[model samples]
Target chain A: MSPAEIQQSQNNQLKFLDKPLQADATTDIIYMMCPMHLLTIEEQVREIKAGQVLSILTDYDGALDDIPAWCRKTGNEFLGIYEDTDHYKFYIRKKAPDNKQNV
Target chain B: MKTIYMDHVATNPLHPEVLDAMMPYFREIFGNPQSIYEPGIRAKEAVENARASTAALINAKPKEIIFTSSGAEANNFALKGIAYASRNKGTHIIVSKIEHHSVLNPARFLEKSGFAVTYVPVDKYGTVDPDDVKKAITKETILISVIHASPEIGTIQPVDEIGRIAAEKGIVFHVDAVASAGNIPVDVRSLNVDLLTFAAHQFYGPKGAGALYVKEGTRIVPLIYGGIQEGGRRAGTENVPAIVGMGKAAEIAKRDMQKRIEHVTPLRDRIIDSALKIDKVTLTGHPERRLPGHASFVVEYIEGEAMLLLLAGKGIYSASGSACSSKALKASPVLISIGIPAHLAQGSVVFTLGEGTTGEDIDYFNETFPQVIGRLREISPYAKGWEGAEDPTCTVKK
Candidate 1:
């Protein structure tokens, strides 16, 4: 297939895998898929302090240096990360009240 | 919904009539134009007819036309050919700072080969002053090459005035008319150009075909050396089908030039007007003298790649200046040369409309663009202090 055809197929596959979101009061988890470096330190801290777990999906191209540094700076729990074909999914939990001191 | 293609300056879709004229040559009528067979004679006649059509588009004689594979090749031939042919006369050549890579790269190559080149600077609106051209000319200047219209910013150069200056100095004037050929009238006699290059794909014709108009009696060497094709100027078998299509497209453009200009200019204006209404946005290049369907702007504080992605999500296709350059992390040199700051230049986008573009497409862009820019800017740290800051570089003040 042509490059354009392959791009279309990949876009279709991405759309199929992107499940719809439901706003539930019982759960405190928010998901975001963007470049890890795009988020500033302040923005990442604000999201963690909102009493919600944040799951971030990022491409692995240069995330090794950024994600770990972000976790250390914010003192948020870095559950783990898994690599997919061209992207990686990272799970992070909100810090307990004792771990929320400003660094 | 059908895709809205606004990237005509990149390449145009083949005109249906031009394709109809070329279909036969690709199949049963395939023959080398130089052969002695009947099919060969037919192919030769078609090529000659195309030559005439291309020549007429620029008001040049048919014999003066030399077909090439692309605009880059034609530009290479024009610059290298003139530099080699006139090496003894002078080795210095003059060109504008904002020329397309086709002209710029060839000139740079000549520079590396021991030729001296001077790049004339343009104003913030990308207008190359004729006085600068005259002042840059020295006794050792052999050629003065400039773009008729910039492909990226759409500023139409004052070719006629520059032509007069070149004439007084006896310097050979070459205009890269690849961006302006179909949208505007290009009269070689009136422009006084010694050589001109044009690509068919810029005018709703097929890609891989272009023509260089070398005014009669102008002495220039050929870039290729093999068979005696293109009046022994360019060698190798002709691309018959593409040449035929280019010819037909030229004919149609010659006949319908005014109507196409009228149709596209309003769409261009509507898009520009909408863009201007937004805060901290700047239009690049000359306003009144630009191409009819060209609209380029810099939306300050937001990254161009992010804007491009947002527009792509909305099914609105456009191009960022940074994306167009090959492997260059720097912002567009054309934008930078015209005094736009690097931060603002990073937000630049170029939109080129074509024959099929409509008012609805412009409306869609206007409605969708402002919201996207606003969203991207909100997330940007650079945007904090830039609210309502109307820097001199934020708008084209021509």
Candidate 2:
């Protein structure tokens, strides 16, 4: 997505956090060690495909804000964010505008 | 949690005397300094009293000092204000690459606005060579800014020498003495600087309190133009309590500067000695010319954040020059510029001994530190998984 679209989607994601969340079993878990400024949405979106829940643990503030916005903009579910001592646990589920036909 | 503060260079706890002096201003004399009423007059006097004390610490006249919200603002005023003031005189500014972001950022801002900036490189000791300063100066060079002492590496620049060059060339010189003032002697007249910056918190004063010393007859435009406050140089309602605290802190610092050097030096020596005992450790900055309270080291292989966390677990506070702890996870430019390799810079740790720090605290740190490093190293991922068991891909171990 263009920088402006990504920004608009990010604005929507912060707004989405104020809304309710839903959870499911098809969630994929991963640890993203890169700091937020270095991490890109394209890099994250490429992994989960469409219609899969993604759980990410990251300490970077940019990632905390960016991932939720990316999820909302791409028509995915941002389930919720949880906190740990060293990192924040973010749960995002992908929604299929274009499913790769995975289970 | 155990309280062991090794982060004085970041910000210091307020001196008790400073806190006591500021207490009455919080409630009793809460009137604005700009008001014409009796309370206003009293408040104004309090601010002037602070101005006097802060000025006296640096041997400047009271009228020369401008109260700023923080040292960063003072830095902005010093760099940008002078650049704006001397627009027709010249547009080139020279600064050391290791300056605090406050100084460096303003210089960059001036660059964007058509002013030319030359970032002079530092020697491996992080000390700026006066000869380089002499070489960098050109016909268009209007200003030279260098920190009086670096907080990151604790290398005090030779501002007195640099000031002489700037004066000789008829260019304005500004020095950021935020980290140097409370710990060392910073006489503005002796230094021959056009402008000097100080933050109270660096010297055990309250946060939100800072001062800029502009030498008399120095023509610099005000960054903030509004009210007739700060002698109309900086126009804002003064931070009265913080200003009062800063005054008391400055007064105490001046009175006890020598004694402070006597107290913190031995502990600083011990911390540096103990950290050096660990294998593959290298110290940063000038060995002899560094701040009396500072001891910085880079422990190779392990990341600084992991070591910091492990140290924090034992309640021994420390700061890192490491990239992992930074917002962008980038190695400190100061460390890199000082000739520490990027891989080595990742393990940088800084320990600053404060007024409250004692030999006993140093002992506790020394006793706990080796274990902290060992534990972190065992899990470092760069080190071997187990004894005699190593992967061919583990280049760090190799």
Best candidate (score: lDDT): 2
lDDT for each of the candidates? 0.79, 0.80
Candidate 1 lDDT over residue span B249-339, tens digit each:
9999999999999999999999999999999998999999999999999888887778878888888777875333423546677887899
Question: What's model 1's lDDT at B79?
Answer: 97
How do all models score by TM-score?
A: 0.76, 0.76
| Candidate 2 segments exceeding 4 Å error | A1-103, B322-325, B384-398
What is the lDDT for B319 in model 2?
88
Model 1 pairs in collision: none
DockQ of candidate 2 is 0.01
Evaluated at residue B161, the lDDT of candidate 2 is 98
Q: How many clashes (backbone N, Cα, C below 3 Å) per candidate?
A: 0, 0
